[model samples]
Target: MAMIHDSIVKEDVVEHKLGFYPRIPADSIFTRENVTARTKLRAHLNTPLHLATMENKPNSIALLLSMGCRLSYNNLDMSAIDYAIYYKFPEAALAMVTHEQRAKEVMALRSDRHPCVTLALIAYMPRVFEAVQDKCITKANCKKDSKSFYIKYSFDALCPQLKMEDGNNVRRKSENVPKSQNIPLPALNIKYSFKFYQRSKLEVDALRLALNDPKYRPEPLCVINAMVAHGRVELLAHPLSQKYLQMKWHSYGKYFHLANLLFYCIFLIFVTVYTYLLMGSSENYSHTKKAAKCNLSDPMTFDRENKTEKNNVFNSDFESKVAMYTSTVAILAYNAICLIREAYNVKQQKWHYLVDPSNLVSWLLYISSTLMVIPTICNYFEEIQFSAASITVFLSWFELLLLLQRFDQVGIYVVMFLEILQTLIKVLMVFSILIIAFGMAFYILLSKVGPDETGHHLSFNSIPMSLMRTFAMMLGELDFVGTYVQPYYKSETDILLPFPMPTFFILGIFMVLMPILLMNLLIGLAVGDIESVRRNAQLKRLAMQVVLHTELERKLPAILLEKVDKDELIEYPNNKKCKLGFLDLILRKWFCNPFTDDAGLDLVLESSEDYITAELEKQKRKLRDISLVLEQQHTLVRLIVQKMEIKTEADDVDEGVSPGDTRVVPRWSSPRIRKKLRTASSFNK
Candidate 1:
């Protein structure tokens, strides 16, 4: 049998000038008509042929081609033969070519030069099959029969295993075919059926495995449900929700009411306690008794005569009681005001407000509260008294100072102002005490000396009489009488003395001078405290400002450029900008500026190496210092341990040995030992 070999010759002609050329097969037929009509007729005929020629039979190409169909052929030398075929027969022309047939064609024509062609043919097969199965070729209206014949011939001939064994078998097989070929091809259908079941089984198994696998299970859904349940349980169990189930509780409103009630209670309690304490003091009793005797309504009516008489009558009398009562009232009033204000603030939800309640208004309230003590003082000291006025003034001043101190504790400025105010008040009180002491001393002097000896002293027997003299001296009014006194008779008072003798004498000798000295000391102390507080505040403010300025500087470049411009940020001079105040040299040393100007850069560069060297030197110094400190500490520890050891050894020796007994040492000085002693002594020496 003669073998009929069907070969594809693909030519990529630039133009479709359908003319017989030298490269064309002499017997080959050519046409310019569309390939659709031929493709259909061939498909109708070849479909049955393909079914009939089952069981991997050969001559499938020839059998189909013999039935008035043609295959695609171009000059065979073109590298893009497979691509050209695919491009020309993009429709059902490729439909008849199976994957196996396409694979075989690709292998047979494989070449480095035609790699794209092999890839194109491989890629085209599946697409062509899908299009054919979807019946999309009919939409193109090409020569379907010719296209189909070309596809079948190329597929079977290119597939070496499918080719006929003998050329004679091709004709015999076509001729022997029954004319009544109406039976459906079961084998052709069976091939697709097997593929369909295989794909379906794979899909089912994948679905089964996905459902069974823990990794694929819907854990998020389970967690979401659990969270929902937990949230519901929490909401149901919450006390706030239960308490305000019907009516929601506004915390602000509740707090306000409670705070107001607390404030009122505290205010009432303070007032009641203060009144009780004031009434119990001795000054209140004297004032009440004195007011009754004189039929007086106020304590202020008690004159100096009545005060002196009362002081002479009862040494522990009205002044002391008044001081105690005033102080107690002042303290209570101050605290009450603070508590009330705090409570009000808590109610108003303005807890951060730093307002002081014991300010001007509170001071007025404190002064008014002391009005209740008036009647008692007037009734007790109606007639005879001395100037107990200083005591009352001092008490009031002391009370104000104490209140100021409390205010200072609450706020710094208040503390500072109070401290200064206290210093001034104390100075005044000290001067007043000196005046009083001098007046008492004058009274003693005047009473002990007769009026004739003192040269007509006017009523100097009384404390008040002496107080007048003391005041005249304190006010510089005594200079008129100084000319009459022997000490001032020879003096020329034109030049002021550096240290006035009288002032120094009074300041030095008097016990009252002690308070003045203490007051001066307090002034110094207050000044020092203020300086410290001011420095701390300044440092804190400076630090905050530095941070603020740095942040602003960082953002300034961006703002100026209208974009994030890092390069234009402001730099520091000498790399010395620090978060702390300008005085902190250590922090300045550590801080560096990347955005330095030319001058700054020059300075930085000039000093950088030197600075590093200096830093190293500093570190070395620090290390040495640390080493010294460590050595000292080690020595101290060793000494302590030695002492401990000595003590322990002493204790052990005493415990182990008999009391009052001495242990003997070997003599080594005996005659037998004489030689040993000489050797031992020589070694010791």
Candidate 2:
């Protein structure tokens, strides 16, 4: 390896044809096309750049470039920077991208290199990601004649197992071995006329890559999760990203919706029925007993008691039957299935899975539902059973509501709700101290008070209760008379309320701050959050749609996936029209206009006129640049021809002056013809 590198670096002799057009002799031997050549500790068909990048030698790369070593990609369609990104060597990649010559000229000219955006994102190399963007799109690096780019990043090949088997970047059979990289994607045309283009200020190249590819290709779920995790939420609003997500939605999204709907519907029915039967039967029997006791003096009391006994007997009979147990088991089984799916995702996505709000909520619901059933099986107290059952029911229904957001038509509302809720929580977090202070004050003031005429205790007797009351007041539920006035008036004057004036002052402040100022501020923030969500509703919906589609794909059968999978070049708006089959018609009708309408799909792809115009402008720029280069070359050739002609004329003049001619040059013959020569000859004679 050292000898090979030394040979490449030391061979500095240049051969010139016309004293100006120089070519490096070493380029012929150590050329980009010569891949079969091997060296110690280097893989077959690897170049010096590949070796340098693999070993993380930035200086060696710099020296090789300075020696006129072209930054040509090897057989893998990978440039030196690609190899650096693949091997997780950010410094080496940075070195290559930061080099003036390599970055501006070589990288610009070589648009065929594998797309490094996905790899950089996956590796979380922000600096390298930015550098690559600068190389590809920045004004200093983009050339007019640069090729139209189409990056076919293949996610199927990004698996670690495939990375190892595909020996495109592996080392030779030696002590050292090279590691690997991830992600595959479709072609994206980032080339645009520089006149109309400007680099984006946002650091969201990964999300742009995810959504901006020219081909409406589906990326892996992990990539989307990475975007969210890294907070590239701003660029999700790009038109291309929105269009890409719409394509994914139309692919197999309807089927996912139907499947989830069916499954959840069944689970919810079982949950509702089980909860109603368990809670209703016991409560109704107790209510009947209370009625019978109150009407004991009446003649119908004995008859009512008999009827209540019969009803209680009937309730007991049904509660112990197989039908009830069947529902319990069904609910349990549904939860178990959901739990297993969550567990599988957790195993696959690990940290990302754990952090997702939807996943966390689903886990919570599953656990609560499972615990809800345990009380019945073990015959716990009725109050405890009701408490568990009530929680389980609320969460199950709420889970259904959340699942409904998988559809774009309804997702916007859920997004708005969540956005407002998030704002409200943040506002509350900042002002929660006021609530605590007021709640503690109320607890002290009301702790000494007794129940009212209706036999209800003052609601602020405890700190938690007081806080709850204050929060309620913040929401416009202030029971002023009951909380303060009635508590004071109902108590005796002998009770000697010590801090009435101070309490009133604090109460006035609490009312002003909590109900008026803080509540209005919260409302304003909620309004702003809603507007922001509305502005970004499309992006948020697409992101949610991505998550839904990914989950659907994971749950779908392979056969169905094979049937529904899209081709590489998905022609939008006119992509195979919906068939007249029953299922197709149902899906079309169900997801019309907003999702499956042809006109709506047409909006996803850029208009042909715009695309053609941009492309033509780019071509014109390229042609102009080409003509400029050719003109310069032509002028240089003319100068060379002029110099050569002058030399030829001088030679002709020299040839014209024959040896006997003494007119023009009379060169070395002067020695014989000189006067001194004649005088010397005479002296010698």
Candidate 3:
């Protein structure tokens, strides 16, 4: 059956992919053959969840979900969610993510972590981190541990605590460990403080599944650090993320953040002026010295041979030189500040700081800026200087857009643009295979019968050339004289169509399958996905804004880093009481203390669990009421059928049917007739 002609099967009622089996939302058991355990429905389970995603009906995903079909089967397992996401089905993926979140909330009961944060920790963070943590004991126990700055600092922080609790048991793990290590431990700071946040096995498993299974969860927005490492404003949206966000910094500490921006702006201004000096005017190289180096005592001659000495406008203009000098100084200062700021953020935020796309984009621009400096210092290779500066300047605009994302209105659209572009590229990538196959096919056919004796191969000369021709043809650029006439001209007015059969088939297929038919397919897929894409807009915007804000917040003046308020610092999962009293300090000495501040120290988790439980209970009650109503309606329907039967029996008697004749009506009261001796009279009444 699987190998049957697809065309013949399409002629059947079920082959229309969109809305077939309208009543049966999920696939039925395909087990008519053997009717044994091996031939069960489980083996061939198909689901509308799979259908909805592949069809780009993300809007329909939730609708299908409401139909109560099993989401996880061999055909559509948890990874299906990721497949949807990878193919740009954001809404469908969102539905899957939300379902996973709900399931976790129900299962975990009172787990304090946000689903998103839990997800990020599991998905975005290196899987290697767990292994790294496991080996930290051996690393810390190394004989030369004290030689490293971080190891020494972290040991000093961990030494003050003598006892620790692991679940139901309390262990004095800290007592046996060295208190004076020198290595700069990966998770520590210059302040020599260490706060170990714990995650349960269940949470870790959930996160792990989220990364591997499509149905498990969505990717953390732009792959930022988990909320535990640092904070993004977007994390504030979810209770779990909010907890992590609160644990991290709440605000930019100083006006120096503004100063850094101004510095970059100053750098850009200088770069623009330098670009103008290099490329803005013509014949300005006349006054410059003709030397490999910019500084020399010689007459400047810039022509075809000595092009390197050309465009030295800075040599002639005093202000351009001043701008050049000032810009160089600004660039150096900005680079140093950015580098230091990033390092500070990494120390405070942990490994998550490096995962941000915005940071990566900034790094590219910074590197470009740094490269431009080499040319600037030598005061040579003006073209290279101009080229590098232009690229840096363009990328800086993107960085600006990233920064502007802190503003909601602008951020939302920019986020939409980024996602849309990403999705479009993915869409184009799908069609690339067909494009390449067609291009290769066309190239082979044309190369076989390419060009006249004059060797005028219009597009058949090379694969790239044929690909461009095919692409142009797809865009309605078919050149008869150039493509066909020049290549296959038999004589002045007569021309033999090269590989007429292949040409016809190739062109026909390319036009029909790709440009005409396949083009519509692309449009349908994209259009189908638009609503699904729109569904994720808010979360996507939040994710982008968080990235931008996190970057800016890190650049605040050094003085402001120490002025954090205790009130603002209090957030979920990571909340702790300030140790103001001597007793508070004393309580921290033993990890075995029953009233450990780290455990259940906040009411938020408990309250959130209660709210979720109450909501679930409320829904269950409503379903119970609905079931009762359905039962009553069923009883009413049975009574109506009985009444109709009794009426029909009476009509039969009036029509003078034979007395011994039996009515073939379905038995409604066989037991009632048996119980009553005076059957006719009693039944008539």
Candidate 4:
């Protein structure tokens, strides 16, 4: 019966038509011969149908009626079958009967001897009724209200035009036919069936079956859906891209550092060369002075003979020409050195060379070189004596002016104390020269008086004669001075003083030793200058150290705070755990300590808890220290402000008073305040 029903469904779908069959007894058994007969009948009718057993006895009549099937029995309680046939298969009903008559017909059919006849009738009849009822139900539910019913066939008959080696088709044919024969028969064409089952498993299995079956296979909807869901993809480099960005930054940073190193090296070389040249020239000058002294020419005789031989030695024209050429060379060298140094400074971005020792020395040499050119060339013009005294004074003035200019540029208050030391040295040098000159002049003037009542022996006859003899003694022409005047003044009758005339002359000679006095003064000046420079340098170094220490102190707390915030350090992962104790770790890592020991590590371990607490306390201490430093800085700033105010007030007071008028002294003691301020500043440094 199942085979017959399946065959009926296939056949009915192919023909696109409906079929109906009579109901059967509930206890009836189905057979193969019945199935074959039903299959043949479906083939003959060219229609598809299905069979189903009704579960509810009362609804069986109603279900059959809704399905539109005919009654095939009488005297078999046929009222149910009649009602089912008339109601469900009104168009499919070939006959109808009452219940008693239907029951009698069913009993007679049961006694009749037709092979598989009952089974065939039962299988095919229900299927035909079901197919008709389904069509009617679908029509009733369809909003379009379709007028005709059609059957969807199986693969066999539906695709007749789709010729394949294994002949199979799954489509339907047209159910509508023309009312008149003149309409002409429409040509039948094969069309594929696209059916959807309401059952989920049926739809899935249908897709799987279609994919597996070679002959009826079609591309499944799932394949296209999957392709759209996951398509072309790509991989990108995140870490490598970041590394490339960092590499660019490092390259630029390295280039900048290299450029800085290059400039620094160039500056170092220039300073070295400049210092060498200046020192070399100074050494040469010292050697020249020594050579001049060793030559031992008589200055007095040289002066006298030089005046006599002046015209013979050099014509005025030649002298003037030599002076002119020397002056030009000196001017050119001076300007060239100045321009070159300026250019170098501009290139190096160092506008202030005064702060640099090498640069200062080089500049001093250049000044000396310019000054020496005039003196050296003056000899070529004999009339100009090349007065060292006048040149010294000029050079002193020049140096003073340069120092003032430098002080102005650097700031007056900053360099004023340094200038004071320099000025003191100059004053001492000048005073020493004057004292030596006065002593020599005084000795010469006092030598004229013979032994007086006071027991003073003055052997010279006249002051001018004594002066010439004094000069002669000074020049080491002692015999000429003594022989020329001593006999007349030093006869045995002449009273003799306690000290001999020659002893006084020897004492005058000591006073006339300019080099010794000059050397001592220079030594003193050099020592003072060095001390001042050292003090300034020490102050600057201390200031820098203070700043560096302060920065380290400031940065340490931040680093410690950062470490504290990363609480993972308290219970670090085993792989990352340090073997050392906290103090040892901090000393080694943070303080960059080189040494480690078991004892020290034990100490660190013992103090770990205290160390953490101490670190927090240290952080607070650092904060307090910073606040104190800030307060000190603020106090210093206030002091500077007060100092400035005092200075301004002093200047105002001075401005109101006339230069010749007696000025009133301010009650405030600025010098004492300044000393205290300086002491404070030194402490800070």
In candidate 3, residue 595 scores what lDDT?
A: 23
Give the TM-score comparing model 4 with the true structure, all chains together. Answer: 0.19
TM-score of each: 0.20, 0.57, 0.43, 0.19
lDDT of 2 by residue, 1-685 (tens): 5565555333322212111113434455455333223233234445666667888877677766666666555666666666776677887867766676654433232223334234343445655544443333222233323442222211121111111112344321111112212111122221122110111112123224434533322334554555555645543433333434444555566556777788999988888887877765577558767877877888576786777777767856565445557777998899888878777888868898767677767777777777767766775435666777888888888888787666666667877887787778887888898989988887776555544323233566567888998888788887777655764676653333345677788888987888889878888888888888887776676577667767776666645654544323222222234345565466456643234434433433347896898799899979987998999899998899898864544344445555456567475557756877789889999
Q: Which is the better candidate, 2 or 4, if ranked by TM-score? A: 2
Show model 4 residue runs off by greater than 4 Å.
Answer: 1-333, 336-446, 449-533, 539-685
How much RMSD separates candidate 3 from the native structure? 22.5
Best by TM-score: 2
What overall lDDT goes with each candidate model?
Answer: 0.37, 0.57, 0.47, 0.36
The candidate with the higher TM-score, 1 or 3, is 3
How many steric clashes between backbone atoms does each model show? 46, 6, 19, 35
Error of 4 at 296 (Å): 31
Residues 72-167 of candidate 3 have per-residue lDDT tens digits of 424433234434544655445455434422322211211112222223333443222222222222213333324331121111111112123345
Worst 10 residues of 4 by lDDT: 565-574
User: What ranking of all candidate models by lDDT puts the best one first?
Assistant: 2, 3, 1, 4
